[model samples]
Target: MPADKKPNSRTAMQPDDASRILVTAIEVGDIETIVALYEPDAILFSKSGRAMQGAEAIRQDNLGLIALKPTFTIDFITATVSADGQLATNRMKADLAWTDKEGKEKRGSVDTLEVLRRQADGSWRYVIDDPYGSMRANLERR
Candidate 1:
């Protein structure tokens, strides 16, 4: 999947550029632009125990969250990229407060363990996008 697809206008991301893409998607909620950074037929094995592939699946999965946290943003104070800058594993604490489908006001936070992989294009994408370590992170925390 080496993206030798002409230099053109797209900036060649420096390996761990996935963070920028991820952050951008969260901030803007634009699935098309975000998925463009990844392989056309990539599969995401999410930590939520959801396995999704292609643009539509990923888009819908993210859209489902918006009803809860309409505007998602990461507050990563100590997110570090790998030595080669090809991967990044972060421990981020996120907070979201919203009314659920049942009209219940709830505040929640998750300690995340996110993983990113460098694609053949030298740009990084979330191959295993584990934004939340597990439900346990939310359940165990008081």
Candidate 2:
């Protein structure tokens, strides 16, 4: 999808639907579809733990991944909806495969955490996406 083009009208009526749409968009390199899945001020945490916020930043970040022509399989762990039914949290593991610049296939997996909010239109969109959310990083005690 072109950067200047309008995003797709796909709506995530269920939390898991959002995950399905996301993985499909990524696999197909549909930037507009991927961007449309996020809220305007959404935040996305990269594999390196760098944070990219807002639509533009998120768009740019995903563009890099799209360039890799990656494919993914998402295994959903859990999804918890708030009592008010307006917010949800999701945890999943994404197995990724892509070809590097040298044309060698690479494979890896990452744990993801996503926060989704129900829009007034009754659809869900991601507000926070952390690709490495489940990783236990090394930390030093003070």
Candidate 3:
């Protein structure tokens, strides 16, 4: 689907649905869809150890990722919704494939933690996304 194409409005998005949609958007290099999945004040903990806040910053960071033409799969380990159903958290394991700046294809795995908030319209959007959430612990164990 084109980046400009909005998600289907008929189904209300759950935390898992939001994650799946994000994976699809990234695979298709759909920057618009990716940004739409986040709340206006969302924050992303980038791999470079910087926090990217708001839609514009997130968009700028993702542009670099999208330029890599990455292909990836997200295996959600867990999703827990708050009692009020307005907030949720998810743990995921992802396998990614992309071409590096050196013009070589690379594959890697990552652990991610994501926080989502329910929108007024019943859709869920990401409030915080940390792609390297588990990297430090994993590296320490090795």
- Badly placed stretches (over 4 Å) of model 3 are 1-12, 137-142
**Overall lDDT per candidate, in order of appearance:** 0.55, 0.81, 0.79
CA shift of 39, model 2, Å: 0.8
Residue-wise lDDT of candidate 1 within 1-142, one digit each (tens)?
1222222323326433454455445444555555665555565545555668777777776666643544334555345677977776555566656677798887766555556566666655555555556454554464
lDDT of 2 by residue, 1-142 (tens): 3333332446888886787777767767778888889999999987667788999999999889878877787765578999999999988888889899999999988787899999998999999998778862621111
CA lDDT of 75 in candidate 3?
A: 64
TM-score of each: 0.59, 0.86, 0.84
Clashes per model (N, Cα, C within 3 A): 0, 0, 0
Error of 1 at 94 (Å): 0.8
Residue 2, model 2: Cα distance from true site in angstroms: 18
lDDT of 3 by residue, 1-142 (tens): 4545544432337787766777666767778888888889999987756798999998998888878777777666578999999999988888989899899999987688889998998888899998878785665566
Candidate 2 CA-lDDT value: 0.81
Highest lDDT: which candidate? Answer: 2
